[model samples]
Target: MTTALLAIDVGGSTSRATLVDHAGNCLGQGRNRGGNPGSNPPDLANAAIVAAVEAAIADAALPGLTIELALLAMAGPKFKAVQDQLETALKALGLTGPVVFTGDLQAMVASVTAATNGYCIVCGTGAGAVRLRDNELDAVIDAAGWLLGDAGSGYWLGHQAARAVTADLEGRGEKTALTSAILGDMGIELNDDRLPDGRPVPYRHFVDTIYAMRPIELARFAPMVIANRTDPVAARLLAQAEDYLVQDFSMVFDRELAGPVVLGGGIVAHLSGLQSRISEIMRGAGQVPDIRLVQDGSVGAVVLALRSAKVTVDEAMVQSVITSIAAHGLRARA
Candidate 1:
């Protein structure tokens, strides 16, 4: 009997779905824009998720095939709500199977660490860390939200950059290339008309401008802070972000868990310097955590789905699936 699995990873800005076989071999995948329910209205976010999953199944040419299992890794505390909506939606779409809901960090751990006893730290559009002990969720230091937290995340870096630019424009901070770069990117002239009182505008306006841009494009600016890390202002911001991540992970380490720390998400995949800095800080706290990056959570999602179906995932099988995934990329449908 041929068995298929559907795996979904829902994040703050987008949702992804993958179709895989019992042996961890990927068959198809799809993605769509959708923020976390904590950040967006539930109805709107759930609609986007349903669309993404349908598109993936259609792209896979697997219509009418019975899925053996379905796994979801959703962001935010409202995971159960999202899971319920997804299960009902999938059933309406004719997918009958065993469904499991969990945090996005958990899926990253399963994908990268390959052990139930490990941790996964995700720093992408937002930042958060989670640890597992004996295959159970043991601890977490959530980013909360961009307004209150998300330190060490792309949004946090971009937000800081915007603040710096505004400060320099207002003559409150030293001028840096970031000021010119940001204004140029936004196509906003710092003329008198644009600045009514001939004074620099509020920092929130600039932050809004950054947010208005596409996520990937906006996230690209995060590395600029790292690139200019030597500058006191930039260094201060980066250090603070790194510190938050260290604290988040340290809280879990304090519990005395025996597991390596696995890192995931867009920011972590792109920011080696930041990860190294956080690792150093963790060491100073008397915790030596082994860290590695999981470039794509879908890889782990497939593994999870397969395991749920009582399928074995050996290295050879994992490598075969990974090689296929690499060729197609997580965003590409198999």
Candidate 2:
């Protein structure tokens, strides 16, 4: 009988679980929809977590494999409140060992390195930064949801783009490609409505369309902004986003800024243009930035689980786990 470790990473957009052995060999992987209780209802979050864990256990198909530990890196702020319920759920699935709960950022930073102290920045639908000391959160920067902050987040970029397009439509701002690009993507035509003077005033329609949905849905337009980055309006927004992100890193340090800065989230991880701009800006500030990008936090969850089980791990071991997960067709989203 082989003893296995169960590691789960719960994010706002997706939840993932992986089963691994002592040697970092991936036995199975499972995925489910967004499970962030902070962003989603508690019932939905718990269901997603349980479903992902169950799928991973079933996929392992190891008859005598006993899960010795289960570690969940969750995005919810009040995870401890539900830890007992989550543990009971895991136990129902045959987990015998203790279940541990950790912050999503902790798993994210650990995915790429063995260093226990550094910083982490997440720039997906929302943006935030954290300082980690001894693998625990020491300080935070700008994680204050969409209304309060999240300056460089996807929602921020999309909201800025929409505002610029509205300004352009109402003849209040400079004309740019974003006007047509955004309207086209949203299936809103300029002639969708008209003014009293019979002018093609699409701004009304656009405003109504935007205000009709949940604010977070604005992040869906972020890709359009990135796609039209060469446009002056889009370029300016992207630059501002880069500036905000770099500022986030700076504010978290509040001293000398340095490396092992692990970055996650769609904007920072997938946008090569923004990544280069950030590096260039950080260099200009006289800091050698060692920014590592992790697609999601699953691998870091695995690393944490292994360490908790008294298994020695290094960068090489992490890489091995990455490769093994890939070999098992458990690759993270690109």
Candidate 3:
């Protein structure tokens, strides 16, 4: 009967569970739809969580394998209820270990960097920044959600693109590729405003309709801006996002800012053009920290759980787990 460690990364779009042994060896992995309550309804979030965990347990296929410890990286409100629901799900999967829940940002930072003192910038469906000392949160910035801040986030870009497109249609803003891209993505005709009766719909009608969509749905428009990075409006918005993130990092660090800077989420992790741009900007600003991308966030849960279990894990062990995960791909299915 092998004892296993369970690591779960709960995100706005999906949840993944990874099972590993004491030697940092991958056992099984499973994935399902988004489970974070901040980005999903409670029922949907819980269901996704259960489905993913069940899949991982099934993949492990070890009847006597017991989860020694588990770490859940999650974001949402009404946490007590969420915890209860998560606990029930874990029990159903026969994982009775004590589970530790942490903010997704904290888990992300821990996953990539080896330093205890550093910062994390997440550019996902919603964006935010966090500072960590000794692997715990020290400060937070712009995680105020889409309605308030998250200045350089995907939601921000998508919402701003919609606003700009509408303004352009109303003769209030400069033209940009976003106009056609957004309309195309939404399946709205360029002449959607003009009825067969010849009366044009108000620009507000377009804006309102788009607003009626879900947050993650609207975030779909963000990549269009990135796709048109050379367009003036898109370039300017990207610069704004970059500047906003840099400024947020500046606020969290000292005048002599130098430490591990872990970059996670879609924008930095996937967009090489933007990643190079951001790196160039930071280099020019003379605030270069040790930057690294998360190979697999589930590895963070494993590392953290191992540490909590009083296992002495060095940087080599951490890097090995990351390497193994990447080699196996994100969902180490077998």
**Backbone collision count in every prediction?**
0, 0, 2
| For model 3, the run of ten residues with the poorest summed lDDT | 269-278
Question: Model 2, poorest ten-residue lDDT window?
Answer: 250-259
Better of 2 and 3 by lDDT: 2
Q: Which residue pairs show backbone clashes in model 3?
A: 13-34, 14-34
Ranking by TM-score: 3, 1, 2
lDDT of 2 by residue, 169-284 (tens): 87778998988888998888865567896545688778889999667678888888888988888888887887787778767763353558788878875455556755665677
Predicted candidate 3 versus true structure: per-residue lDDT over 203-259, tens digit per residue: 555677786877756667789988988889988887888777777766675434456
Give the lowest summed-lDDT range of ten residues in model 1.
191-200
Model 1 lDDT per residue over 1-334, tens place: 3447888877767888887776666677778876367655678778877777887777678546667777877766565676687678888866677688767887787776567677777887778888788778888887666656677888788777877887787778887777766676676665433355565554446656766764434555676776676777777777777677767876666435556678887767655465676567557667675777787777777776777777776656656666766775644623
**In model 1, which runs have C-alpha deviations exceeding 4 angstroms?**
1-3, 79-82, 191-196, 200-232, 254-256, 269-289, 312-317, 330-334
Q: Quick one: ranking by lDDT, best first?
A: 2, 3, 1
Error of 1 at 209 (Å): 4.5
Clashing pairs in 1: none
What's the CA error at residue 36 for candidate 2, in Å? 1.3
Q: Higher TM-score: candidate 1 or 3?
A: 3
What lDDT does candidate 3 reach at residue 26? 76
lDDT at residue 259 of model 1 (Cα atoms): 65
